[model samples]
Target: MHSAIDAATLRAYRDTHYRVRGDTPMTLRIDQPSPALAALHQVHGVDCSAFITAANPHSRRCGDDANARRQLALAQDLERMGLAAMAAAGEHPSNGWPAEPSFLVPGLSLHDARMLGEKYGQNAVVWSGADAVPRLVLLR
Candidate 1:
């Protein structure tokens, strides 16, 4: 509801790649339609997805230990919610920022996605619908 994130940081979120890794990988770009994501959704029988992380909360850099703990906690939360989450990362193409550990959660509702992002103190999360077009959902 409140937007305090700066323009440059917001731009970076848009430019970043939200990658879901495994045997078959997916690179999701904000505002771009991804066939791989569509296929993943179909496989999961879900029409919605969210790419989220708890690392570097509020965009402030933290130690690996701290980041890892936060990320693990988020994963646990997802597991407790019974949502199927795939290991993923948010990467900046220019290598300006270290890849943040993330998850691609199929069937996550938009409301829940926003809640998680804000709960984790994130500026934004990448989300998609049945159209498979990833969008930058800000939570600041």
Candidate 2:
């Protein structure tokens, strides 16, 4: 259950607001059960989802262009996999970090979510099961 990510960064991930964008935007908090997410899951006919991003790999800040490119690649990869994705952002409540473009991928399994996290060099991903309780899944 351990990862190479540092404690501060791990704490930051837990504190991040994983915002799912739309006309009625929803901010998903770690370890919190979201009614909005439960409704979203009902819409998608899914029992689970994941909040993933392709920015600041391994907790290292990168240029906007690089982050954008990585984000685009992740979108493409998800498209190729035939998965559903909603535009989202990883925003720190205190503005300690820049809001990173992210995705709320409905129906993405926990295993696949972890794989995508590893693929994009993320330290962790926010995942929710049938109960809609998002947990931080750490990756090295």
lDDT of each: 0.90, 0.91
CA RMSD, predictions in order:
1.3, 1.1
lDDT of 1 at 27: 92
Judged by lDDT against the true structure, how good is candidate 2? 0.91
Per-residue CA lDDT of model 1 for 1-140, tens digit only, reads 55799878888888898888986698999999999999988988999999999999999999899999998889888989899788999999995799999999999989999989988999888889999999888877
Worst 10 residues of 1 by lDDT: 1-10
Each candidate structure's TM-score, on Cα atoms with residue i matched to residue i, is 0.95, 0.96
The segments of candidate 2 whose C-alpha lies over 4 angstroms from its true place after superposition are none
Q: Over the stretch 15-128, how does candidate 2's per-residue lDDT look in tens digits? A: 888998975489999998899999989988999999999999998899899999999999999999999789999999995788999999999999999999999999889999
**Regions of candidate 1 where Cα sits further than 4 Å from its true position:** none
